[model samples]
Every structure is written in structure tokens, then in C-alpha cells.
Target: MTQPSQSNNNRMVIKLVAIVIGMFGFGFALVPLYDVFCDITGINGKTNPYAATYDVNTDVDTSREITVEFITRNQSGMVWDFEARTKRITVHPGELNTVEFYVKNPTAKDIVGQAIPSVSPGTAALYLNKTECFCFEQQPLQAGEEALMPMQFYVDPQLPEDIKVFTLSYTLYDVTGTSSVAMNRG
Candidate 1:
């Protein structure tokens, strides 16, 4: 009787340990899951990834002008100089515009960086489309090397009339150590 009871207790302990491990795994899984939810709903100002299949033939709406402001930031411990060349620009809806950002690797060793973008007044995210954006890929800069990153985008003509000003911001994160995992994770 004593042997059977001990075996049952051991089995229970193993089951509890497995449950705890499973719960911990679920917690880590939530990070990506939350990102997907925010991206789809635009609840957190997360900009949608550029879509290659999007139609670009829409007519430019010249009657109204929307001011787009550019903002750049470097994540903590990032040793690169990054800034937008153009502070802001006014454009007609549906017209393609190009802007440039300058980035220099000031450190002695090569580094890789990834840019994550967000649009203020989250509602504007749905109408802002990018045709060509450096944020779409990881940027690798050699020591003391500098490069100009260009982004081509357009404000959809259907943008809500109430939003006359929209801000597009990018936060560059250093991913030198975890480049492979961070590249696709963002």
C-alpha cells in the first residue's frame, strides 16, 4: 500500500511540473500574439508592413494637403547616429513622396540595426502606405560607414478629413547580437 501511494504522489508532482512549464511557455508566446493583435487593430499605433500587392494606380487628391512629420529615435545603447534629413512635408493625398534618413555607424565594429515604425493618431496608420522603405529590412553598417536610407510612400486619398497632420516615427534598435532572431521577429 505504501509503495503504491508513493508512486501516485510522484506522478502528481511530475504532472504539476509539466503544467508549470507549459504555462511559462504560454507567457513568452503572448508577446508575439499581442503584436499581431495590435497590428491588425491598429490599437497601439503600430504601422502595417508594406504590402507588395497593393494597387498604386489611385489618383492623387490635390484638393487637400496633409502634413507628414518625420521622427527618428535610437533604442538605448545603440551607438549609431540616425536622423531624418527632412523634418516635415506637406503633400496631396495619393501622391508619392520620398524622404531620406541618414545613419552612420560611429562604433569601431560593424553593427546591424532594425527600424520599427509607428504612426501617431493611430487612425492614420490605415491610410499610410509605403512603396519602398528601409524599415522593411535590417540595415548593416560597417565601422565608420554612413548611408542614406530612402522611403517612398503615399497618403491614401481616402484618409479621414479630420486628420490634417500625421506623424511617422521610427525607432532603430541595435540587433548586432541577435540579428537573426530579431530580423523576422519585428
Candidate 2:
């Protein structure tokens, strides 16, 4: 009878200690854990989760019709819209051209958003190229008003001398965007 009572008392102490340690671990993991959750859900930050891959022949002077795409994930109660200045463009290898990315606030009130673009290798990007990008600048859109953001870029015949294929990917995220990373040379 004495042995059984001591065993039960020890088990209760062990359980209490386990709960306390578990809570401390949980508290310590809060910040990192929240970051992971935001990354997966696109809540705290926006990322280019997907990009369309395309290959251009830098050897020839031709026109390329590349569709830039925008995607939002796990958003709640906000409507966002995006458009491009031109759907098709013509350029020669080593010649840089400017393109546009248009974002709109479709809601009844002013909406702010950000755009992040990732251009493929052997290509460059510029802000002037976008007629309406809310990326480098915070885009504050009035209800039903559209803005054009621009990016200037081109494919270089000088791409690594060994690379032949390139792709550009853009991902727009966050109700409030905070980053802009660019590739300036082909």
C-alpha cells in the first residue's frame, strides 16, 4: 500500500513538470512559429510562390508575348485586381524594353497593396517599364481606380555565355507589401 501511494504521487509530479515545460517551449516557439505560418499563408508577407517559365531566343530579333500573372492566397474579405500594360512585346537580344504592370483597387474604399516581380535569368527589370506597379511604391488605389506600374528589362545575348533559357516569375501578396528585389542586367 505504501509503494502504490508513492508511485501515484510521483506520476502526478512528473505530469505537472511536463505541462510546465511544454508551455515554456510553446512560448519560446511563438515568433518563429508565427513566421512560418505567415509564410505558408501569405499573411504577414507576400512572396512569388509561382512564376511562369518561358524561354526566348536571344539569337534573333523577335516579338514575345508573355503573360505576367498575379496570385493571392488565403486572403479574407478583400478584392484585388491586376493587369499589364501590354500583353505582347517585341525586342531584340541586347535591347531593353519597358513593360507595365497595372494594379487596381476594386473595393468601395481605398486599398493599398504591393507587387513583387522575379524576372528570369538573362533578363533585366526596371521600374519605368511598369506603367502601374505598386511594388517599390505603396499602391493606394481609390475605389475602381486603376494604376499602371512599369518595369524596363531585356534579354542579353551576353547571358553567362552558356545559358540559353530564361524565365520571369512574379508574386503579389500582402494587404501591405514591404519589399522589392530586382534584377538589373541580362
Largest TM-score belongs to which candidate?
A: 1
In Å, residue 47's CA in model 2 sits off its true spot by 12
Q: In model 1, what are the clashing residue pairs, if there are any?
A: none
Candidate 2 lDDT over residue span 5-35, tens digit each:
9999999999999999999999999989997
Cα lDDT tens digits, model 1, 52-82, are 3346687988899999999999999998999
Q: Among all windows of ten consecutive residues in candidate 2, which has the lowest summed lDDT? A: 122-131
lDDT of 1 at 95: 90
For candidate 2, the TM-score is: 0.44
Quote each prediction's TM-score.
Answer: 0.78, 0.44
Error of 1 at 45 (Å): 1.5
**Candidate 1's error at 56, in angstroms?**
5.7
Give candidate 2's whole-model lDDT: 0.51
Each candidate's clash count: 0, 14
Model 2 segments more than 4 A misplaced: 1-78, 88-90, 120-134, 161-165, 176-186
